[model samples]
Target: LIVCTHDLAVTLTQRPHHLIEYLARMKKRVTFLHLRHLYEQPRDKGSPYIRKKVKIGGVEVRAIFAPFPSPLLNIFRGLCVLLHVLLFDKHRYRVGINQGDPWIGFVFYILRAIGVIERYVYEDLDYNPGGHKNWLFKRITEIAEYYSIKVSDLVICVSLNLLRLRNRWRINRVIYSPNGVHLSLFSRAIKKKAHPPTILYIGSITEYFGLDIAISVLPSLLKKIPEIRLIIAGSGYYLDDLKRIINKYPEIKGHIIFLGRIPHEKIPDLMAESDIGLAIFPPSELMHYACPIKIFEYMAAGLSIITTRGTEAARILKKYSVGLIINYSVENLKEAILKLFMDGCLYKRFSMNSLKFSVKHDWNKIFHDEFKEIESLYLEYVLIHKRTVS
Candidate 1:
């Protein structure tokens, strides 16, 4: 059973979606409880819990719509989960996974404590305690996370820096796992010559993410190589900021392609056509811990990476001998882009290295390393969900 804070079908995702697919392939039954986003809740203020399946085409969801934001949202979610526990067999799930939000972890901890779930794994994708702006909510999440960590059987951290808190308390059962890519999906995506020397920046558009820096270097890059193209995909809180940059430099509009919030499936196709993948995030202590899924996906598709200096992405690239890393400046970015274009051997070496790096980091291998037949170990107990759930 998987309990996620966000809708798997609707959000700009990576981790939870991959987990669901991985579990299904192992022939384990999935019982999904999707807590809809605040905006997705019912407008009839009183009638907020609109429960049903979203378009998770293959997974069977015993859906329960969570109402709009309230201090008791987590409590309401816990009640819905409890209802499911009462409706179905009490010990229906052998293993339970909680994705996102520390509050959800409290529910899983309770489930584990009472033997409702045999094992509880808390996958901490972003291990940031100060991520929430609200002071009260931040403290509440810290308390909940502290409780969850104490109770969970395993705590998976996506990046190395996530180990800091665990180290402080000597905790972090510490699964140092990174994000992965569906290699077969990239294999099936037909690569076409979309344009001349294209650089792709496909991810949630944000201020510190360096989309503006990519735009700023374009005119200078175009001076040397006229056909240099920039493809910017994905939308976020920083879309308005990026648009302001684009508006200020209207001449670069024709040189750039904006494919706002591309579907998850279509990302591989974009990766295939792209020559360079830009992950130019600025310097930040918090960002150093980030394991950007796009970087792994870029490697899977054999796209040369150009990441900022001293980031996890840069470290991964340098470790694999895949791509270039430089300071966060327009000139440095333009030079890196040009260098890949000018040096054939260097470009080929980077591309080959990326492909080789991807083989080991494929979703299958990563999950296998992390799970190690734990699914099969529990499969015998889950022969049939004999108890029906409403």
Candidate 2:
């Protein structure tokens, strides 16, 4: 069973895609339990718990949706989840794979203790506590995460930094599984044109994502390279705030374009149209451990990048010479953009290196390599359990 806090159909995003692909490749019979509001089909107005069957890449999948909407209602959601498992899922699932939802971990822990779940794996992709503003909520989240890490049989972290943090929990197994890109999706050869240079920023427009920093550097960038354009894509809580910020800067009005929330399939064409990619995450504990998927996508699309220092992805960018890493400041960002814009040969070299580095970090290769070792252990456990039962 694969458990996630986000809706599997609508907001699965990149990390979940990797997990789904892994399950499909391993040909594992799996049930996906989503414990969140139904964002994709908000008008359903049906039962709180909905069940359906779906197929992905010829793999059969059973999906169950249980809406919890808010963390304050976790107790109710936990009851709903426990009831569903006891009524329909008991003795049917061998392992439970949770995708880093601390709140939902409570139910999984209980299921494991009661023999309903034989094994549990917790996949921690991000440090989410830094994003929560309410002190009570943050404390609750921290406690839940601590218990989740302490109780899981295996812990999979997305970065070395995260793995190191989890080591303090004395977990039985902790594996580093970084974010990866779908190389084939962005491998199309794009012809370079002599039109105005464009810088692209694709991801959520959240305050911590540093979209404002990108906007702050636009005026200076336009002054250095008048033909330069900034294309801001993706939508989030800060969309209207970003628009207001852009409106404040009259000089950059015509030079900036906003393409709100581009579909995942159309991102490659958007990448092909741009010369540079911006991936600036503000300095925060949450971002320090982040391996942004956008960085890998930028590399896969063969675009030079400008990212803030101290992130796990920035280390890879710096190591491969695929992009520039600078401080999270407007001045540093402006300088980096100007330098890349002024040096055509350097940009081309970085672009080539980006593509070269991305090939080794493709999602298919990463999952195959990591899961080969993991599945062996899982199979042994399954065989042992079968023998004991028989």
Candidate No. with top TM-score: 2
Residues 273-313, candidate 2, lDDT per residue (tens digit)? 88889888888888888888988899988899998888886
Give one digit per residue, the lDDT tens place, for model 1 in 123-231: 7677555455577867776787777776776777777666665657677366777888888887643355555789999887777589989998887887798888899
Residue pairs with colliding backbones in model 2 are: none
Cα displacement (Å) at residue 15, model 2: 1.4
TM-score of each: 0.84, 0.89
Evaluate residue 140 in candidate 2 and report its C-alpha lDDT on the 0 to 100 scale.
83
Where in model 1 is the C-alpha error above 4 Å? 38-51, 54-59, 67-91, 133-140, 188-194, 373-390
Alpha-carbon shift of residue 106 in model 2 (angstroms): 2.5
Instruction: Provide the lDDT at 320 for model 2.
Output: 88
Give the range where candidate 1 is weakest over 10 consecutive residues by summed lDDT: 41-50
Alpha carbon lDDT of each predicted model: 0.74, 0.77
Model 2 spans with C-alpha error above 4 angstroms: 36-52, 57-68, 189-195, 380-390
